[model samples]
Target: MVRSSAPLRRLGAELRRLREATGRTQADVGEAIGRSHTTLVNWERGKNKLSKSDLVCLLAELRVPADVRKGLELLRAEAGTGTSPWAVYGLPDWLRPLISFEEDATSVTTFQPVIIPGLLQTEDYARASHATAPQLAAPDNIERWVAARMRRQQRPRNDPHFRLHAVISEAALHLYVGGVAVMAEQLRQLVKATETDNITIRVLPSSRGDHAGVANNFTVLHFANPSADPPLGYFDGPLGGHMVSDAGDVAAMVTMFDDLRAAALAESESASLLAAILEEYQ
Candidate 1:
């Protein structure tokens, strides 16, 4: 089955918003366009593509302004083009949606048991980590992967409205990803991130023993408009990664995140741990 993508999701969200502005139910629009509400709902959910003709019909039925229609048309066009800035990195198809969804999400919650979260990794640390992955062992692929990872970091760092909460294992702190100097700087960077209001970093102490997140690392993306763009869960594998969109699956991830948070050190205490680790490296 063809999975829904970030571009399609964004486009669908815009369409949903427009439809809401007109105060029309999906059934009403569907009837006007000679289609079933299920079909319309699928289009609005990004589960199915919206044809050009149908889009035009829907826009006309809604009496959208010419300018608004133009913008929607542009979105529709982009939905099909498969063009994301990070696409140039030659990332696998399964990976691009994770980056794209991250770019559009209002908040992201992540758990890392083995290493630093991608958004928190320093350049050298990222390089070191990528070099160990078989798929990214090539020098060029490592650079590209690092560059994409760095670019993904900008959203959480720079956008106040884009919140990031990371629950990381204490073991990850001692992994020494890039050796002494790189790990030191990476730990220092984590401490620095704690100063930001939008970024929350928590450490799951090793004393916690077995935990809900011990199985794997994962991230959940949430949108400002939940009805249109629902929460999504993503996790990596040996070949690539997969996005989890089922409401139940995403809810389970949320539960797991809450459990991790309950077991993790508070933000301030985590910062202290980070500082202590940084000193050890120094």
Candidate 2:
């Protein structure tokens, strides 16, 4: 298992929170753990990982409960490897940030009016879609990109905090990306994925005309921190991508998402829509 930077960062944050809850200064904690305050600061910043012994000592000094200790250990387990297939093939710089956020998100809500969201795409659908992109069409690169997308499924399955909700436009079901056979498989996968407790798929019918999100596709990522200023928003672009972290921008996008979800079909209705589309292919 390759550890991601996100887990380490989250661990650092939890450690800081624990220290604060205990009303102990970094200097005080460091003294108890036999480390310098600067070293403790670096660990809390996620700039470096604390040794196992050091972590044990710090936890003991901070009076961290068993549950918190278990949580930190889980995060440490996730911090082992950083390189994914996407990183290995040098995916675009802008995409790397999205990948990191995707890895860490507690909940992901997406509105995709144009096509199937990447995380839900089947391998064949992903390949065909990527092959059509002018900048990403290189035969070799398309395979790598598709592989990277498939790897994202690992997060939802393995990470307890991860949850995905995608509201797809009806047009995405109508458009045959790879071919009839490929689309059939893709739809089948979508149905299967929806069965997972952590995933939800909803369809926004075309009949809901001229809605708030007709012109854009965006994803909102919520973290575990309720008091965090705002969730992250990601929008795709013709050339690259855009990330919105500013409070105002993210707030507006989130409002739009709420509206989109309201206008979308209920979960059962969405499943029926998918089934109806699949029947057509059959």
Candidate 3:
């Protein structure tokens, strides 16, 4: 797979926006030119740049207006432009794409089975979440990860257009990670999140056993522009996590989310549940 860069990603975002406006699926475009779906997805993700002929073919298939074609041509010519700070931070290689995609997302949805989602975790909670691993215990590395988490978190807070909907398993509420006091503080922080209009949290009760999310955590990031950039699905892998763009994979992840959501308490109900759990620690 081709690595994504800032410039190409921007171009892909543009193409995605245009294509969606015309109601053409990635498969629709790829199949027209005998390109694989993976290749089409990669191009839309800015991971791969399409050649002039390919771009022309795509533009023609999308039935782009003559007036708009010139602007797209300019964008295509500069698609391979931009760098990111992911390299400077020395974060894991597999993580860079996720970080980039998340930052640009219009909305994000996450489902976590055993712990608070990193974006919503308190600093101490985040530390405890990772403290279980000896490899991450060193002060410097812990700080690095925490710092990265902090930076990643700023998007939803700072960007008014960005939204987050996270579904958390009830199992995480009972864990004594970093002790009851830490859990208490973390729960308190969760309550504060409800105050934000753009953020919504749901808790999946333990009673709803054997669900699709029993396997692993996943995040779905939606873009405002479906043509320039489409929604992306992410899941953990052996190294870090993998990004899913293929229609089938992304659809499966969405289905998993729907299942998790069905079993989860609504935002208001989850807040009440969280408040009840907080009292136990006190």
Candidate 4:
């Protein structure tokens, strides 16, 4: 099943906030609306959208002010309309939420321990990386995944307001993901990407040994309207990935990201190290 779209998630979150303000449990609100608590839970979680009448009933049950009701109606309209740009890639259910969150985020920060961060990967590097997975080894699957990634990369490259900071492991530079030529070009592209003011790339030297982000790769998305939609944390896995929404967990992820950045080399030094490794590949 497809996950909720970005607007739907925001709407759900806002509804949840209003419901909490009224000090009513889901069961209480569900009973008042003659719907099951489970149904209300789904609506509040963004797993399912409420109908217009249902939204009206919910607002009435919560006794929300007119201004609040108007804003929610607008959000509901946005959630109900249009298709996301990534809809064409046929991305997996679990991956769609990540794309949706990234698309709406004002800035993104990622800590990569093993390979290049997705938003900074070149086409060849991405294809080579995806080819290693048994499920994505097919030519069509590789191409589709690569295309999705490339399209996603455009946000950080083209959107002046969208900023990206990538903390990469030193070992990633020597991994030779796509062999000499591909890896060379990938590094060259990484070097070129640093020339843009919005993109900052740093390397966490292997010498830093056993840091805050040693376990796996993770990405954090920060929005312009943080009060309505707080920061989100995500980590990929064998099946798909998991979105971190709990306030405490998201806070920890942010702290870990800060530590990773501190452990990494400065931008200029990272660039110098990248150049040194590129020489080895040549």
RMSD values for the candidates in order, in angstroms, are: 6.8, 7.6, 6.5, 3.5
Query: Which lDDT tens digits does candidate 2 get at residues 1-282?
Result: 654546666788789989999888999989887899988876775546676778888888888888889878877777774445456765776677688667767899999998899988988998888877756567767777778888887887677568898999999899989899999998998888778888889899999889988889999888776463237789986678877766789889889988888899998889888988888887
Residue 266 in model 3: shift from native, Å? 1.5
Ranking by TM-score: 4, 1, 3, 2
Better of 3 and 4 by lDDT: 4
Question: Model 3 misses residue 141 by how many Å?
Answer: 2.4
Off by more than 4 A, model 4: 1-7, 18-42, 45-54, 57-68, 136-139
Model 3 lDDT tens row, 37-111: 888888887766678888888888888788788877777665433455554566775776788778668899999
What is candidate 1's lDDT per residue for 169-214, written digit by digit as tens?
9999999787899998999899999999999999999999999889
Q: Estimate each model's TM-score.
A: 0.76, 0.71, 0.75, 0.85
Worst 10 residues of 4 by lDDT: 1-10
Clashing pairs in 3: 7-81, 13-228, 14-228, 15-227, 16-226, 16-227, 16-228, 17-227, 17-228
- Best by the TM-score measure: 4
Computed on alpha carbons, the lDDT of every model, listed in order, comes to 0.85, 0.81, 0.81, 0.85
Q: Each model's number of backbone clashes?
A: 0, 3, 9, 0
Off by over 4 Å in 1: 1-7, 10-82
